[model samples]
Target: MAIISWREQMSLNYPPLDSEHQAFMKVINQASEDIKKRHIEGMEKMFQACYDYVRNHFSHEEDIMERIHYPEMEEHIASHQLFIKNISQFRQEFETADTVGKKLDASQKAMAFLSVWFLGHLISRDKPMKPYLVRLRNLPPRMNY
Candidate 1:
C-alpha cells in the first residue's frame, strides 16, 4: 500500500522520461508492498534500489535538459538536489531506527515528499520542458498514454 501509484496522467509525453518515471513508481511501489508483506530481509535491498534508480533517472532528465539549453535548468537542478537530500535523510533515518518488522513502512514524510516532488516537478518543470526536449531530441518520445 503506497500513497501513490503511477498513472497515465503522469506521463510527460516523452518516452524516455515516461519510462523512467514509471520505473521509479514501480520501485517505490515494490518497496511499499514488501514492507506491507513484512518481508524483513530484503528491505535494505529494495530501499537501495529505489535510491539508485532515482539518481539514475535524475541524471537522465538533467542531461536532456542540458541539451535543450533549458532556461530553468539551474532551478530544476536545485529542486532535484533538494529532493535527493530529503531522500538521503530518509534512508539514513530508516537505517538507524530500530522498528519491528510489521511496523516498518515508508515514513509519512517520505511519501509526502515524493508525492509533492513528483507532482510539482512534473507539472511545473517537466511539462514545460517537453517541447524543448521534443525539438532537441527530434523524436517522438514514448508515453504512457
Candidate 2:
C-alpha cells in the first residue's frame, strides 16, 4: 500500500509546482513499496532521489516566490529547511541500519515521516502560496529551475 495518496485537495492549482510535488510523492510511495519487498537498495536510491528533488524543487519554488514577492517567503524557506534536516536524520538512521530487519524498520519510519511531513507542508505551506502563484499562470513563466 502507498504511504500517502495524493488527493484533489492537495492541488495547489499550479501545474509546474504541483507536478514537482507529485513526483516527490511518487518517490516516497516507491520507497514504501521497496520496504515491503525488502529492497534496501531501492530504498537507498529513493532517499537520494528525495534529497535531489527537495534541493531542486525548493530552489525553484523559492525563486518563484521571490519573483512574485510572496509575503511568507522566509517562513516557507524555513519550513523547507526543517524538512531537509528531518529527512537527513531519517536517512542517517536508514544508512546506519545493519540488518534487513533494521533497514526495513528504518524505511518504515522514514516513509511515515515523509507521509506526515509532505501532507502537512502541502496543506499549510503550499496551499497558501496558491493565490500568489496563480498570477504566474497568465504570465506563463518557465519552471525549469
Candidate 3:
C-alpha cells in the first residue's frame, strides 16, 4: 500500500506544480514499497532520487514565486530550506547506519516524515498559492504587433 495517494483535493489547479507534486508522491510510494521489501539498496537509491527531485522542484517553485512576487515568498522559501535540511540529516543518519553495519529503520522514518510534511505543506502552504496562480492564469495573453 502506498503511504500517500494524490487526490483532487490536493490539486492546486496549476498543472506544472501539480505534475511535480504527483511525481513526488510516486517516488515516495516506490520508496515505501522498497522499504517494506527490505531492499536497502533500492531504498537508498530512491531516497537520493527523491532528494534530488525535491531540490529541483523547490528551485522551480521559488522561481515561480519570484516571478509572481508572492507576498509570502520568504516564509515559503524558509520552509523549503527547512525541509531540505531535515532530509539531509536523515540522509546522514542513513549513511551512518550503513557504515556501522546496523539495520536502521531509516526508510520507515523517511516515509513517515515525507508523507506528513508533504500533506501538511500541500494543505497549509501550497493552498494559499492557488488564488495567486489562478489570477496569473486568468490574465489575458500579451500580443505583440
List the global CA lDDT of all models: 0.70, 0.87, 0.80
The TM-score leader among the candidates is 2
- List, residue by residue over 62-90, the lDDT tens digit for candidate 3: 87787677898899989888888888877
Residue-level lDDT tens digits of model 1 in 18-90: 9877776666566566666666555666567757866788788887787777898998889888877888887
Shift in Å, residue 88, candidate 1: 0.8
lDDT computed for candidate 2: 0.87
Error of 3 at 54 (Å): 2.6
State every prediction's TM-score relative to the real structure.
0.77, 0.89, 0.87
* Residue 44 in candidate 3, Cα distance off native in Å: 1.3
Stretches off by above 4 angstroms in model 2 are 137-145
Query: Which residue pairs in candidate 3 have backbone atoms (N, alpha carbon, C) closer than 3 angstroms, thus clashing?
Result: none
Off by over 4 Å in 1: 1-3, 101-108, 138-145
**Model 2 — which ten-residue stretch has the worst lDDT?**
134-143
- Order candidates by TM-score, high to low: 2, 3, 1
